[model samples]
Target chain A: MMKTVKIKKYSGELQDFDMNKLINSLRRSQADENLVQHVARNIVDQVEEGMTTKKIYQMAFNMLKSRSRISASKYNLKKSLMELGSTGFPFEKLVGKLMEFEGFNTQVGVIVQGDCVSHEIDVIAEKENNHYMIECKYHNSQGRFCNVKTPLYVQSRFVDVKQRWKSQVGHDTKLHRGGLYTNTRFTTDAIQYGTCVDLMLVSWDYPPQNSLKARIDKAGLYPLTALATLTKTEKRQLLDKGIVLCKEVYENPILLEQLGINESRQRKILDDSLKLCSAINTLI
Target chain B: MMKTVKIKKYSGELQDFDMNKLINSLRRSQADENLVQHVARNIVDQVEEGMTTKKIYQMAFNMLKSRSRISASKYNLKKSLMELGSTGFPFEKLVGKLMEFEGFNTQVGVIVQGDCVSHEIDVIAEKENNHYMIECKYHNSQGRFCNVKTPLYVQSRFVDVKQRWKSQVGHDTKLHRGGLYTNTRFTTDAIQYGTCVDLMLVSWDYPPQNSLKARIDKAGLYPLTALATLTKTEKRQLLDKGIVLCKEVYENPILLEQLGINESRQRKILDDSLKLCSAINTLI
Candidate 1:
């Protein structure tokens, strides 16, 4: 057997190259198992010792792009989310709109009272008599899970509000609900505890067919980050104006001009958004 | 008007008696405004120039107890909660059990993860598909309200958890909700913010009929603090063993034996619990 090649991680640590990790990541894009394995082998043969994980990812991404654009886009979803912003405000806006699409009256940021204290809730939604307080978890990096403690903490806050309601109001009124919404996945323990406690958990690709990704796809509400033609600044400008979904830009078209993109680029961006919307529609 | 008398507060400061504050408090118990006014005038006439507010409260409580037990119980609710413990752990336990009665599966004193840090959730509850995380803001004094900053901090933790989930799990799981529960009340700002964000707020008599006091009374799950027959240490012992409700002691009379009370007092305690339970049953 040939000697295993050493690779460098983003953290500056060196370790033996792991083929399984790459294969698993590729599989996440829904690439065929045979294609993934072949790509992994080809990338491994071409890899220099001490290559960074980022470099390896780029190489695989490029190779995958040649095979399937849809798979490449799927693979790049996490990276695209990171590009939403450092503060994650853009992600929060996206979540708020998603809730609105789901038919809940949504507010982005507001303060709510508890029995003993006041809290600034990130998002609050109401449907008929039921009220929902949501915490939008946005991440700038991939591979991080909402850990168990988050649910614990969130559950604690909900308990406070519920208790407050019990003390101040008579029992006939409905109890307000609390939920944690994230753009990624939760840890096993988080999922277990969250499920056990009935905390509504929505993470990417979690719960199989009804994840944030699935919901966005179903609603055809892809964020501007999905567009390859748009630059980071253009996406930020659009997001800043509360324009999150690509379909919004696709319909308005004029909004693209506000981003100060050249005529050609604006046309390209709009064209790209149309294609993405259609792609999502076809998938649905 | 007859010469108004100055009274001392628990803080050792002296001030003139305020009839409006007294009337408002009595009104909260659903006392007849005329009766409250008449009672206030009578008490004012009897008050010495340098009597304490505690004395004034006691006089009003005694008079109210004779007039209406429901109002008396409502008035005493805050004081009884304060007596749960100086440390507030006992009260937290009571709140936990109360949540159980309201159809939530409850856990007390758990550590949960947020995106940036881990938090010790005071209470976490689940019902159906909703999880409620609570921060039990138990107070030894009755006047304090949960302030704006507490909710701000709680909301921050929620935001952290949401962000972590986004990073770790590609979006599909629901976000765990948050609440703040206090034995006393929340400030106006807290209420405004909480309502705005849909933070489930439950304070003493906040939402009229469906308050924490109402829930406990409806469930007949009064804490040991509400019992005059038990000493502080005895209450603590029962609380430590997770026996928070007086109804629990009434059903399992042997639990009271653990407190080392003599047979005669045990009979009295049992009788008092029976009376209290019947009173609660009547209210429901």
Candidate 2:
């Protein structure tokens, strides 16, 4: 006998369940075809009439977690990045650290004098002979997407900064390289405009192999928000005290004291960080 | 000797001398012709190079404070009202109390259902055969004025509420009267539109006789911000605790203990409240 099914949305509104949404989310994690189908079917069969979307996510996440840790991390990546916005300063700092790991000397939250106006650059990175003026867009909500207007606005700002630097300090100062980085995905229009304007666009999944997710995974520079051992408040406290990278806690166990995590949880976090970092090292 | 003159603006920008501005401001306070001239001339003469507008105001205020207490209060009225915005809740409470003293049974911060939408009415009052909805516009800055757009927005909201009440409960519901009450002066356009629309406009000096200032003066219901005895934080604390009216504090001497004011200061505050209230009583 068929049963009537309803799922509670994030907004607490109950609606008819859609199987395709779960399937797409699972496929995005690069789960195996059979496992994805099996997980989706299992969730549908187990889901009650009034189960919340959060509980549904948990059921699927737990199933994915057992199969593949990396896939589970990728599935939970968006939420982890969203948690970084407890304070904007920490997110900028994390972005700077990520750029640093990519072999660029970076400065976070710097006020640079442009010819016409002063611009606050989120991240300024310098490689061998190139300079990048990065604008880091952070969103606290999962539903917020970086759209075309953002790139357009940032490109104009970048032009002003580039012109100012060229006029004031001579043409040798290369401030033309501009990038818009966001923890969320960019809209199709944003990608098109950014590519046309030669503005570097870095988001969660764009550029496939060199996207923000790939870079973080390759560098083993997971943000503190990625650690499931820490509570939301604990992660916020850690971020507040300027601890953004899980590697920081791994290198110096003393930082975990700030989180007030019990001895066992602290060990688990450190062990997880070390194992994750080593696993990335093996891939390289 | 001609002194190098400069006046620092509220935005902290220093500009060259302008004499007419000061003269016009003094005249608007309804000061006597000679007093206005004398005060303006004296301030300009005593003003040193690079002196702020605040210092100039203090010089004129000191002069007026000694000559006429009413004039001084009138001159300082805008600033006093601005302090009411330390928190919006207290200002709404104060407006409700003012309405209560005017023989209307008042409610503060009530959510009323409209036909198309729900509105959080700032002050709702009911009398013998009339019901009034008041929207309290509170501004924390001296330069901010209630403009035409405010009344236009409020008028639309009033229509929704009126329509909803009419449709739901017939014509005898008595939700016709709507008033826009603000602690600051209204723009000329706002006054014109509100007058044309028959929306009661109660501001600092509009309508001449029954203005907000006049009503507060007649009722002797000065807000806690009007008390010169309390510090900024102390006033905020009193406002937060729902002790909005000086009359409330005057009747309850125990409230002073929460402020941590010394015996002498507490006595002074109570005395000032009693004197101010009695002064209004004498006016009638």
Candidate 3:
């Protein structure tokens, strides 16, 4: 029988460490079973009571990084999303691209006229006469939840913009919806308010069946920041170039060539991105 | 004839220097005419193209400080408001006190139940069967305007809370109004939207005859941070103690005594506050 170890979560809550959950997460990275088992055994020996989950995650990530870069990258999805930048431009662009892949015609960072004023909607998506004015609330740090004030404000903005949209030509019968997307979690009041207001609330692991993370995994649209083969500087350069998804590198090998990387290194980078885009159960 | 020097504003707009405007501002500080003329002459001689209005104000303020501490404190009203702290707690307290002085029964930082959820209203005031829910938007930096989004969201929160208030006992016929007060300025669009929505808007200098600055002058409720005699640390200590107004210090000198300042320095501080409270046209 193994002793239970209580680990501290980011929200400062304590929970018993589940060895099976750790093993399942490592296995989802598509790492070799032997390597996953070895890492799990090492972590079990080193685990202590009251250790932060973030510290535990770092230990596993470093172990995986030393063995295989692609698996490590796949294991680092949440942190990768956070590194997209604090200004939220890259995150907005990523959200716009994700919506486009979901078969919606999307516009990123457009200024729309409202009933009383104009609003800079983060992403606007339209499909089958259904229009969504989405706002992306990105936080650089953890433990910061989108509070009820967020939905309260976003709902008002959507109402203002919808008022203008309904009065436009040939748009009277279309369904208009407001969406609030964030890389972080939302407070209980925020969720309740958003649900009550009919806001399409999406966070990192919310909504059970279809969250931001689930949507990304389902679409196989891993962000470029997740690639372990790319250095932080290189990832920033790619983001600056408006290339967000791993599929962008897998399809266009010319991007690596333009970055002046050696042929062998480019091949390794391309292989990792290709495997990442095709892998099932990429998110833990 | 003096050469026309272009002065840069905080908004990055360029305008010709008006020496008379500067002179009149100094005069409003209630400084001696000779001191005002001396500062104006020195500023004019040193004025050059593309110097910021901030720099000009700093020069005049330094000159006034060397002569009259009371006048210098009054001249520094805008900057003093900014020093009230970034969290906006002190600003809310000051607003509540100011409203109380205007014959309203005021509550600061209260949580009120809304129609959907609860809201943290900054200040709730009632006078003559009229109820008001006020939200204070405080910015620590210059040039940060309260945009249309601020009023848009404030209006929503007001509507939600107002709905709940209407159902309460004996409150059916009372006039409920929403107010947005800011320490800084507002964009034209913000003013337009707020007025259109019937939200009472007050910023530093908006609604010319009845702005925040105007109310502060009329009520003689200068913040303790406006005193030149106190150090920044001392002002912070007083704010943390919930003693926001200079009138509080003027009426009760023991607050300064408790800060462990000697009698001479306390006398100096009290004298300055008394003069500041009695001065007419303290703002320009």
Candidate 4:
């Protein structure tokens, strides 16, 4: 008989342990300083509406295995996007806000479509006559805005998306207006393009005139949040007032408000709650 | 017509974009992190070994997701693991080493049962009147020894293990001889039991005549490992070489003979890899 060697592989605690107990153990051990645990926490926080605990845990797993190679084929090291703090758990909210600003502020109401394709526009929203496609970039920290793709790529993605939309949505305007939002300022070209299209950019939480981002950071998300006309301090307050209050406050009768929450203040509150609810659901 | 209300919730990123593209973007962002890239790189590493690239990526995906809890879980508003400079990858390999030791040391050529249940045993050879079951515990650090429950669990796991001399095996005292080895002295129970049952609690990789439970920290793994080992620089050198090389050098008697290395040196090397590997893998 041909001789053969056997390979034995040791299984970590998972060999026979319950996953729920394992999660608890992980939550406790998260205090340990390591990349594994940090990513684990991000995955946990991203848990949101309709997500299973199993899927929540799986997010951490998926992130760990993903290879972001600026070109892994060459460098043998996948590029990393962690220069920023945990991308806020409610990533989708940022995209929604940008879409709304692009579509509603203009003549038409925009319908959000497709998830963020990065510079390609996180989502393409449709308005009455024009398509106000938007590219929303979310940053967990102001300094960390250095973490996003180059402005060149952002412009390229937008061009590709715009051209593609012309084929599909027939929004081939000789000139089209689309908004861009990034926590960080745009690369030279992106800024110029915004100027070209009459597209406004909410590059930072702090408006250019007031520098609200710095104040918010110093005062904290709670204090400045209350200062916002639409946003309130209490999560429950937002929940109670609900989107109905938002419509009453923001959506004008002239605009033919279909949304219950039209008021900017009430809408912001509902938006915040919806975001929180999503996070809770995802993590649970 | 009845009145209809379309409410926009203040939620996170969900309504922001097309869900499909969102997944793609997440995947792309994931490739940038080391935790994600390493496994992804390694998964493709075996592509040359006849593993499909897709399978490699998928396996990489599965493996990465498994470590999700280890990646992003943070504490003290800082990274728990990344700051320590320890990636869980090393510990994962440590698990493989622990599982492989016995199979490599099996007296009667190691046989792998590739069935539903898989594991290996050392020294399948029967000893005259007594049938000895050798369970080697190559603890590189801790002085703790397995109690009766250890053998009880292991023996139970041998649901249908075949015995060479089925009747003779029954007659002789079925010695659940545990080969206890560590960098420190065995616990009092382990030492006391050493005299009665077949126990070899030899503290090898520790300081000269140091007590078993000396406070030792996994310094090299200092960031990746949390094992406390003896201050013996020589033993630490073996550990520094990594568990796999240490095992090859330490566990192989022929290699030791050919290398002109003394048995004690080989033994220490083996002890370092065994215990270190076990403790480290457990952390993952």
Task: Summarize candidate 1's per-residue lDDT along A1-284 as a digit string, tens digits.
Answer: 44488999877889998877778888766567788888888887888899999999999888887876556666676677777777766777778887888898998877767765556677878778677778878877776678765666676667667666556554347657778888877998778767766778889877887898777766656677877667677888877787776778999888877666789988877776776565555654
Q: Report the candidate with higher lDDT, 3 versus 4.
A: 3
Candidate 2 segments exceeding 4 Å error = A1-24, A27-38, A48-55, A62-72, A147-149, A167-175, A187-192, A207-210, A257-262, A278-284, B1-284
The C-alpha lDDT values of all candidates are 0.74, 0.76, 0.89, 0.35
Model 4 fnat value: 0.00
Off by over 4 Å in 4: A1-132, A135-146, A149-166, A169-180, A183-201, A205-224, A227-236, A239-284, B1-284
- Candidate 3 residue-wise lDDT, B209-272, digit = tens: 9988778877778898999889999999998888887888899899998999999999999998
Q: Could you estimate the TM-score for every candidate?
A: 0.47, 0.49, 0.88, 0.25
Per model, kept true contacts as a fraction are: 0.00, 0.00, 0.59, 0.00
Question: How accurate locally is residue A272 in candidate 4, as Cα lDDT from 0 to 100?
Answer: 36
List-wise, what DockQ does each model earn? 0.03, 0.02, 0.57, 0.01
How far off is residue B263 in model 4, in Å?
7.0
What lDDT is reached at residue A172 by model 4?
Answer: 58
Q: Higher TM-score: candidate 1 or 4?
A: 1
Best by lDDT: 3
Compose the digit string of candidate 2's lDDT tens values, residues B186-261: 9886787677667889887777989877777777777767676678888888777778777888999899987688
Model 2: what is its DockQ? 0.02
Candidate with the greatest DockQ versus the true structure: 3
lDDT by residue for model 1 over B1-284, one digit each (tens)? 76677889877899988878877777655567777887788887788999998888888888886776545555666788887776767777877887898899999988777654566778888787666777788888856778755665566555555565556553435546778778888888767766765667788776768788777777777766667667878887887787767778889999877777899999978876776665555654
Task: State which candidate, 2 or 3, has the greater DockQ.
Answer: 3
- The chain A TM-scores for the candidates, taken one by one, are 0.77, 0.81, 0.91, 0.35
Sort order, DockQ high to low: 3, 1, 2, 4
Residue pairs whose backbone atoms clash in candidate 3: none
Could you tell me the TM-score of candidate 1?
A: 0.47
